[model samples]
Target: MPIGLAPTVRSKFEHHKIDEAALDGAPMFDLPFNPGVQIRGYSAINQPNCQIIIEDFMPGTEFDWTFVHDEMQYCISGEMEVEVSLPPLYMETTKAHITPGTVFSYPVGARKHVKVIGDAPFRHLCFCPPSPDYPFPTLEQLKGS
Candidate 1:
């Protein structure tokens, strides 16, 4: 088969949707920059060039974050508004409401403020290019840079 003129072939790889049971017991990470927001997740793939993680964010909390590397997130459930500031001056911020099935990407050095809304947990699958021990930089660290 050809996809846009590129040769392709089907493989025997099996794919399955992440179920409710798989979301349980994710290890939580402490966010010193934003307290009271429950951030828990586990990494399914952490390799040299790629990293995949399933993260759950509890509702009714907002936090500021800056990625040290490039990342893309696919929302599986819940809702949130992410306001990403343009770098350099950061005089303006663009906001987007992310819902289930929405895929959002963040370039390295982009700063975003995430506000988890609604009553349920906001769950998303995150993909990154670099396998950093912790991908997000602290607010103070962002300032020091």
Candidate 2:
């Protein structure tokens, strides 16, 4: 089939990665957008071409905005509703329910609205290519919750 496998094991891009537990002490940042929502994130991978982060949004939080980087996200836990639309005019919306193992992506400039959908925090792992024009949050931007 087009997708290539049943009960998918891992992404073709997967490689031996550092343990996520090792990043437990990494600094957290009150990520931009979704203001007032208890959403926090910390870099788990900061490579020259790309970066990854584990981000969590407390229940009822909503993040609605356009993308500045091409990116992909995988739900690690909890649930979410994401609405994405291509730019030029983000008039139409494509919504999806994101659960464990759900993977989604959007091109740069696509508009996306994501809402944390349940009691527990909605957590996901996000990956994006690094760009000097719009850099990722630095550890210095960390703050106590």
Candidate 3:
């Protein structure tokens, strides 16, 4: 009943293939204007030291501005446009266009938005540090929640 044990259980399970089909029919977060499928995620080093999530963005849909402890992302399937806002400075930097196979990382307090284009969906993986005070709510509890 202690923390940081789920990852061990997950590791014990067989590794499965990562493919579009595997992601199909998956449950995703739908927030009015934003549309994306959250494929899979894991709590790093056990219960929740860090988390990794794979998302598929629908065309014209976006993940709105939100702050995190820290984040790193990689484009795995399609194209996207990312807009980031930094705190203290309130400065906004935008990556107008990004294609498949691109990778990037952001600081702990960055606010970010993601937009997908064309008919194809944008698939990417996100990494974020585990912190109790992360502005964005953690999905860690959803493993049971």
Pick the lDDT winner: 1
lDDT scores of the candidates, listed in order? 0.74, 0.68, 0.59
Cα displacement (angstroms), candidate 2, residue 62, comes to 1.4
lDDT ranking of the models: 1, 2, 3
Q: Give the TM-score of candidate 1.
A: 0.74
lDDT at 78, model 3: 78
Report the error of model 2 at residue 67, Å.
Answer: 0.8
The root-mean-square deviation over C-alpha atoms between each candidate and the true structure, in angstroms, is 10.2, 9.9, 7.4
Flag the better candidate by TM-score, 1 or 3.
1
* TM-score of each prediction: 0.74, 0.70, 0.63
> Clashes in each model (backbone N, CA, C under 3 Å)?
0, 0, 2
lDDT of 1 by residue, 56-132 (tens): 88888789988788899999999999999866677777889999999999888789998899998899988887667
Compose the digit string of candidate 2's lDDT tens values, residues 69-111: 8988888888988889987788777989999989989888999
Worst 10 residues of 3 by lDDT: 38-47
lDDT of 3: 0.59
Off by over 4 Å in 2: 1-29, 131-145
RMSD of 2: 9.9
The alpha-carbon deviation from the true structure for residue 4 of candidate 3, after best TM-score superposition, in angstroms, is 21
